[model samples]
Target: MAFGIMMLFVAILCAIAVIREVKERNFLAVGFAGISFLVFGWFSVMTIFVSGAPEM
Candidate 1:
């Protein structure tokens, strides 16, 4: 869960990076950021789903 949350944060940052790279017309950086976003996002989401959310 902790790992998932950390990855989720990283994924968000990568998403922001992707947008910045696109705006700057840096396709190479965009590709790398986009890939990291996808991989981290998928891993985080799956991890959360598999572990289940905490109850309030």
Candidate 2:
């Protein structure tokens, strides 16, 4: 539960940064922040519910 909450908080921060960059008309920053959001969200979900490793 705590991890989930932290993920949400991070996502919100990323969203805020993206919005700020968009308003400033900085395309590079916007793209970077957007990518950051995707990566952070993806890793957060993947790490939390990961499956067991396969046998060698």
Candidate 3:
């Protein structure tokens, strides 16, 4: 659940960054947005695959 929240936060931040980049006409912001999305995806996948409890 924490990871999910983190992903949401990153997504919101990315959206804000993209909007700012569009207004400022900066291409580097787009790169940062891309990296943020990749990190979000990675965290989501890890959260799904990694369980807190071990299965016997």
Residue-wise lDDT of candidate 2 within 1-56, one digit each (tens)? 45755775787788899999999999999998898888778766665555333546
Residue 19 of model 2 has an lDDT of: 99
Give the lowest summed-lDDT range of ten residues in model 1: 47-56
Off by over 4 Å in 2: 1-5, 51-56
The local distance difference test score of model 2 is 0.77
Q: Write the per-residue lDDT of candidate 1 for residues 1-56, one digit (tens) a residue.
A: 89999999999999999999999999999999999999999999999988886766
Q: After superposition, how far is residue 11 of candidate 2 from its true place, in Å?
A: 2.4
What lDDT score is found at residue 33 in candidate 2? Answer: 86
The lDDT per prediction is 0.96, 0.77, 0.73
Report how far off residue 5 is in candidate 1 (Å): 0.4
Choose 2 or 3, whichever is better by lDDT: 2
In model 3, the Cα lDDT at residue 7 comes to 74
Which pairs of residues collide in candidate 2?
none
Q: Please identify model 3 stretches exceeding 4 Å from their true place.
A: 38-56
Instruction: Point out the worst 10-residue segment of candidate 2 by lDDT.
Output: 47-56
**By lDDT, is 1 or 3 better?**
1
- The best-first sequence of candidates by lDDT reads 1, 2, 3
